[model samples]
Target: MKSNFFRGAVALGALALIPATTAALADGEASSYKALDEFMDVFQKVRSDYVEKVDDEKLIKGAIDGMLASLDPHSSFLDARDFQNLRTQTEGSYGGLGLSVTQEDGAVKVIAPTQDTPAWRAGIKAGDYITHLDGQLIYGGTLDEAVDKMRGAPGTQIKLTIVRPGRDKPIDLTLTREIIQLKPVKWEVKNGIGVINIVSFSANTGADVRQAIRSIDKSLGRKPTGYILDLRSNPGGLLDEAVSVSDTFLERGEIVSQRGRNKGDVERYYAKPGDDARGLPVIVLVDAGSASASEIVAGALQDQHRALVMGERSFGKGSVQTMLPLSNTTALKLTTARYYTPSGRSVQEGGIEPDVRVPQLSDPDYKNRPKFRESDLRRHLINEIKTDNAALEEDSKDDPRFAATAEELKKKGIEDFQLDYALKTIARLAAKPGGAVAQAAPVRKPATH
Candidate 1:
């Protein structure tokens, strides 16, 4: 017999459908009555006969994960705990082993340990594959499961067994959890050039950048001739923060745009007049880890000729995710729309390529070390020639001029190639006519530890 009661229950629980389930509906209309009736019968049959008292939350989350996993690696559902962690990342404080872990090649890989955190101090480097945590094998587990195992209260200890490239055996390291406050922005006047390092885009990122710029001005008593916005290894954050950061550098121009399934979803953000830095020669440093909001800022600056991008391609996360609250403290972070640069470029699968490609110079010892290479990973790079060419056609703009090749950059013999290039570029620009004249000011020396 067809279960009419079950059909009514399924109809009431509209939230059970996946994010893309809406697309299954036509013109904003719900599924047909007959389809819902059949779906409910199957759902009840599965629930009633085979399993133990199944958790509705777990089942829902699993369904959500399955749905998102099929779409893209980057898009996934964030439960309450996951959402809290996401919030903590932006606030720059969290209690954990202090390593950024991401899903790579069907397993969790440590991207990099936070500076001065337990993971870094314990000799956990970027590109280490985590095999086990606290003797619990994580080989086939999800990224969320691995993350849950790693995060805990301060002063708590967790053991991580990892496999490195050159090492034959898995190394076990026990680390204590601590409150990690990420330093998003670091600035210094190196060799009479202003160099700013943007580790990530966060809620406070715009304020942080402004503060750094002001501090530089106070020390030098004049604006920098040129500025370097280093976005290397930046995994990106809030979109509003990225827009605000771009606004600081640009006077009057479109920053970025967004497009969705509906034409009404299209929107553009522009820089306000007062916040422009004018014609300061600027360089944006990027790498494979630089993504989303980072890509937005980099793409906008490069397209507008406001900044010269240095380094390899970015992480190419042009999609915008919005959090939809669910009952029982759970939430869904769905990809709501795809973003484009001011020049109408979609960075989705095709990341923003640098105007200048400067690859990292590997030390002899570091070369053989287990480290994550963007190229070595599969999902990191997607051939988006179609998207790139389409966006180029719409914008009708030429590509920016690349300064030097990766080979030339490797020959510099500099410890930090990106910073070195920025300093050199700034110095050259300063020597030009009508450039910023450095004023003699009492340098406030950094305090000794």
Candidate 2:
């Protein structure tokens, strides 16, 4: 029988989401006794003749980890601790520094920080490399070890030594841990516009987004001019949540699709029959940190012409991961398929290119900081059909509108230039004679193969 598919999830750090389904074995594969025999021989040799006595469990787990690591960066064997951590993160509250990180060449690199958390408040950037923790060098250590050292009881302080590129000296900062209650969807009225900031796509994110739209309308006493969906620095989460969020604004259309190994093994998600915002103009704001689920939402809106995507190219992670429970306490996060946007675009190495590329002028380091994306990861899945992203690269020369220095913008009381620009753009569109922001044209429904 075909394996039953369900909800999907993804992450840039230690977790990715999907239905808790067991992995299906190959339909026509013979057991390789020779390989099993070779593995057993090595295990016996390590157990009897190694420098020290190694536990069987440790050796076996190591073997499993090595095998998964060889396939791709997203697949891994999750132990008990990792399984628990995944649950906590998906639930949207955890006590830690609130940073999404990944290991590259034995060094823990920042993926992005959860906004309003200790790491973000302390000005930690996406490309920063963490070299030491609490005055002790942590280089060449396991990612889990670094993560364990970083997370602690709430209100406790930890010192981090960061090695940021383009800086002569390493930067040191002490930050206090806090319960990172990830407010997935937050809304406010910005100059007669509804501004919805989605930090992560955790549990109930879609419902929260629908509520935000309702709340915005209620607070304004009428429909707002437009909406700004701020997905900047979001490190992605549940796949179902992404689809739901996309469905909220869409009237009817295919949102996304995931294709597995077999030719006919494909699943497509579609929006239900209602536009929650009543077809209001939407602008999706993304950056290098926007990934997987974030890409899913952005790509859906952009392809359907439901929203104008603004900001840099996304973090390019289009693969879906299935979490198959190995036992009650552990699981395997295996990359099982590649997802595509409504236009059949797989953002594997080439992320969603924004309709308009807006530079972050309020951050002084915008010019020098190198962007990190899924394509940068070791053993990342290669896109068989390459995408030419030369035109999408951020121009070295600044646009006149973005030439203002961070200090200048700070003086003007504009903390976030991207949001500020999006709000104003919506306002301008609303100012047109009819005062009705343009809605997406009706698209032809896609047929499932």
Q: What is the model-wide C-alpha lDDT for candidate 1? A: 0.73
- Model 1: per-residue Cα lDDT over 1-449, one tens digit each: 36987887787676667545867665345447766677668667767885587766666567678767676556677777786778788775878877888887567897766656798788786678998889988988778788878888999999889888797889999889998777788898876557787877877888888888888878899876678888876778889999989888876688888877697888889887754344677888987668788899998888767778887678667788887877666777777788887766778766888886654543333435643443355543343444443343244343343244446556765556656756776677668885532221222222420
Off by over 4 Å in 1: 1-53, 104-106, 111-116, 120-127, 153-158, 164-176, 275-278, 362-414, 434-449
- Which predicted model would earn the best lDDT? 2
Model 2 stretches with alpha carbons more than 4 Å out: 1-31, 433-449
lDDT, model 2, position 376: 88
Residue-level lDDT of model 2, residues 109-185, one tens digit each, is 99999888999999999999999999999889889899999988999999999999899899999999999886888
